[model samples]
Target: MQARLDQELARKGELIHRWSEGSLHEVDLIEEDYFTMLAALNRKVSSLRESIASLEGTPPPRVAPEELLANWTAGSLHQRRAILKRYLHSITVHPPLPSSQFDRAPLVKTRLAPHWKTAAEVTA
Candidate 1:
């Protein structure tokens, strides 16, 4: 709704340039400007809603784990040598998942927070 209004205002130069030029109710623009915009935006929104409704009833795509690993192994070689260099950039040992026994946050906090300065801090 807000987006449709914004589109209408964008197309109507009267609304855009109204401040200095000062013509809010120009006869030609007021008659056809905002309505045309609302119609087009309504169509777009209707189609997007229809797509969402259709997706709600559809099953998602699936990948087999063995196939994924095989594809990755084969495709990695065909990729540019630059990618090989990039892929070997670093091997990092991230902290284990956060745990009451091991860390300050929940066990599922798998990501490290920024500002961990020392290798010792991470390794600890």
Candidate 2:
């Protein structure tokens, strides 16, 4: 993806060079095409970077658990969601069967994020 972005950037540079040299007759059309391609390439690069970041699972900046607890209490919904996404890989909820006793509790499981697993292994 990075290579593709680099290639597209090089192509854009070449297009501009041609336009500057007055070699391209349809300058307006070429400019339009170049910008369109650049926008799409930029979006692709951004998406690729996000995917790489997720896969790498680099730990977030170190903060005290107390700080996080405070944030959870005072943060906006968006902020809270961001924090949860950073720390939790997933949550699975299993509903109780209708035939099961009413006293039985539903099953809930939570998986920590990849970074947490790495930290745990290091500590162990």
Candidate 3:
């Protein structure tokens, strides 16, 4: 098992569950996948603004994703900053634990329960 990956995912999952009740919160993908979705949404929003500008006489310049999320349209600066900062942090600097730590062999039925064994035996 990738310990770091599992820990990151569990942390993200807990945050998502506590803050959101949407289907997206129940999603089972990596943080990278979530960030990619954010990027896609940001791109689509930029495209929409360009389209709107062509229709309207004048539309203001599009904002960068960080700034846009940092200053959310429907919320206070405190809420916006907190949410955006967490989102941005989640987007970067996450690395999975090494695969060598994963248990690869089929689980064998042993005479004793796992808890019955010594810690050293468990490590072995």
Candidate 4:
């Protein structure tokens, strides 16, 4: 949206420059387009400000283990680390049992605050 607004502003500047240079013969049509573009740019800026205001103080929503796993798999190393650090205070992983596959349950432990509930916890 910001990029589009910037492009429109550049077009408006070009229009004015052309009008000042006496190259544009259709003065009335160009004037109408300039004002319409200006109004649209103002509306875009106002909408962005309102969106920022709405998100400014709000906490992010919690995610389930499945969603977390999906994000973890798709994220970069830094992003994955950030997610781990944000959601867990501490984690412990035990070695797999002999001749058995690795199991997340009964081996891994996480310490999250009571206020930060996962989606599964909330639904349960």
Query: What's the TM-score of every candidate structure?
Result: 0.25, 0.35, 0.33, 0.28
Better of 2 and 3 by TM-score: 2
Pairs clashing in candidate 4? none
Question: lDDT for every model?
Answer: 0.42, 0.52, 0.45, 0.51
Error of 1 at 122 (Å): 60
Residue range 3-119, candidate 1, lDDT tens digits:
653454354334335522546456445624544443454345445444544667543222245533433443324333323342344435466754545765553444433332343
Candidate 3, 1-124: lDDT as tens digits: 2344345445544544543444555657655555554444444554555565566756535345655543364334554554455444232322433677544353233221222334333222
Better of 2 and 4 by lDDT: 2
Which regions of candidate 4 deviate over 4 angstroms? 1-29, 58-124
Cα error of candidate 1 at position 54, Å:
0.7
CA error at residue 96 for candidate 3, angstroms: 38
The residue-by-residue lDDT of candidate 2 on 40-78, one tens digit each, is 544564465555556677532244587467546544566
Backbone clashes, each candidate:
0, 0, 1, 0
Evaluated at residue 49, the lDDT of candidate 2 is: 52
Counting only residues 3 or more apart in sequence or on different chains, how many pairs clash (N, Cα, C under 3 Å) in candidate 2? Answer: 0
Angstrom error of the Cα, residue 10, model 1: value is 14
